[model samples]
Target: MTLRILILLGALSAFGPLAIDLYLPAFPALAQAFGTDIEHVQLTLAAYFVGLAIGQLIYGPLIDRFGRRGPLLIGVVLFSLSSLACALVPDLDWMVAARFIQALGGCVGMVAARTVVRDLCDPTTTAKVFSQLVLVMGVAPILAPVLGGVLLAAFGWPSMFIVLALFGSVCGLAVWRWLPETYPADMPRRPLGGALANYGRLLRDSSFVGNALAGGFAMGGMFAYIAGSPFVYIELYEVSTQHYAWLFGLNAAGFILLAQVNAALMRLRGPQFWLMRWVWVHFASGMALLAVALAQPAALWPLLLPLFCSIASLGCIMPNATACALARHGANAGSASALLGSLQFSIAAVTSAMVGALHDGSSVPLAGVIAVCALLALALTVWTASRD
Candidate 1:
């Protein structure tokens, strides 16, 4: 792919992560502003995940039927509008509602970007391209918190939403001008029933379902971290907002670095081989994380170390599993990508909400949730591989 294509796709994929991570540093401020607990503030993240999960199902058929560009433009415009709505919200409930609306629009970019990759590239090439996309997506987490911290310090949390609105507007304009419609206009448009049948067929495929579950559960652990870290780092560890952003950036850097390593390894080993191997690593790291949280909750390093390893492993697992799943159903790439994204975000949403709901003013909820997700992911991968 050309640099321009890579950049556009990367920017498109980064929108969700940017939206999620950018507001993290402001969580404490948001909770303060709304006279609510941190958990209630965290629900906003869960709301976004819920939007992403459901909205992809709606957009998948639309993209496949009408082609990619039209659905993408509509989604971005909606995202920008909802972002503005979020900025204008007067309370936590309205903020959560606005976030859901924002996610509904923002999720289109993720599904479309993955679908476009499948449309343009073979499976092997798709894995590499996804890794490249990860490199681009990595910038969001690294910059978002730092920028959010700065913005929160300067202009408060509402300014972050305004910036997101501007970002959505710019991305929408870029998609309009530059992103080529990968789905052919002449392609047959399937009826809604046909699209539902396609999803049902994908659900029945062991390889696709297995990889999707594996990826989704692995991502659930990451979402648990996202939901719990603000409390752990800020309240428990007493880190400053700037310091927390740096710590978050450090983990994100590891994730990006390992993603590049996965891309290089893809040149030498297949995605399945690496995916199976990393699932084991992810499981071990999760166990280690739980052990440390149980044994040394007071020491920050013990927990942070294992958490970093687990998240880094996820960076390897996601793109490979995604490529593997999409590779199996090239005939229905849009539906496949949509299902994959929906499952992942759904798992993430559940875990994030659970972490918040189960918050005990300690690290156990976070560590325990991560361990459970890892074991489940590992079991699914093993079961799927055994079936093969």
Candidate 2:
């Protein structure tokens, strides 16, 4: 892919992270605005996760049958409209619903971006391409919260959604004017009824199942961090919202840095090799985080070290796991990418809800959840390696 195409696809893939991170700094403000608790505010994030999980499944078949560009453009339109709705919502319940709708629309970019990579790149190059995409997409996590905090200070929380709406519109225009339909017109289309059977086949493929779940569980841990960090930083550590973004961005920078390293190292190591190695790193970091959280240390640095490591490990883990899973599914790239995304978001939704439900004004819940997820991912990675 050309640099222009790669950047555009990366931006498309970033839609989810941008939406999730941009309003994180406003969680406290949102709770105050709606006369609710942080738990209720967290429901908005969970709702978005749920919408992402369901929408990927729906879009997978549509993209496979119809084509990538059309479904993608339509989804962006829906996302832009839903973002506008989120900006105008009268209450928390309405906000939650709007966020869900926005996810339903925004998730199309994720499914299409991965499928496009599968269409254009071979397995050897897939991991590198994904890492490169991460280099571009990673900018969202690093910048979204900082921008959100600024918007919150200047124009209040609703402006974040307005900005997201405009972003979606720009993405739509980019797709319409520049993105070519990567899905081959000559490739035979599967009957919509067969999507389930296709999914079943993928599930039964041990390599695919193992890698997908390994990656899914790792992603789950990241979502746990995302869902819990605002409370941990702002409330427990007493960091201001603006400063919180810098901390969040620091972790993202680590993630991006490691991803670029993985891409460069790909010439010497296979994706599974890196994936297997990093899951261990992630598990170790997660355990340390849990231990520190259990100790209830007075200082934040003790917790931050392991937290950053665990989050950063995913930089190597995700692209490798995804490339490995999709390597053999070229003909069914759309469906495969969809199922992979769906499973990841489903686990993310669960982890997000878990963090909210288990909130007790402490860091242990988040730390514990990340630890468990890392353990599960480790097990799945081992299983995937055994299959190889």
Best by TM-score: 2
Error of 2 at 31 (Å): 0.3
Q: How accurate is candidate 1 locally (lDDT)?
A: 0.91
* Per-residue accuracy of model 2 over 152-223 as CA lDDT, tens digit each: 999999999999999999999999999998887779976788899999999999999899999999999999
> Per-prediction TM-score, please?
0.98, 0.99
Local accuracy of candidate 1 as per-residue lDDT tens digits, 197-231: 88999899998999999999999999899989999
Query: Could you tell me which 10 consecutive residues in candidate 1 have the lowest summed lDDT?
Result: 184-193
**Model 2 regions lying over 4 Å from their true place:** none
Model 2 clashing-pair count: 0
Report the C-alpha displacement of residue 383, candidate 1, in angstroms. 1.4
Best by lDDT: 2
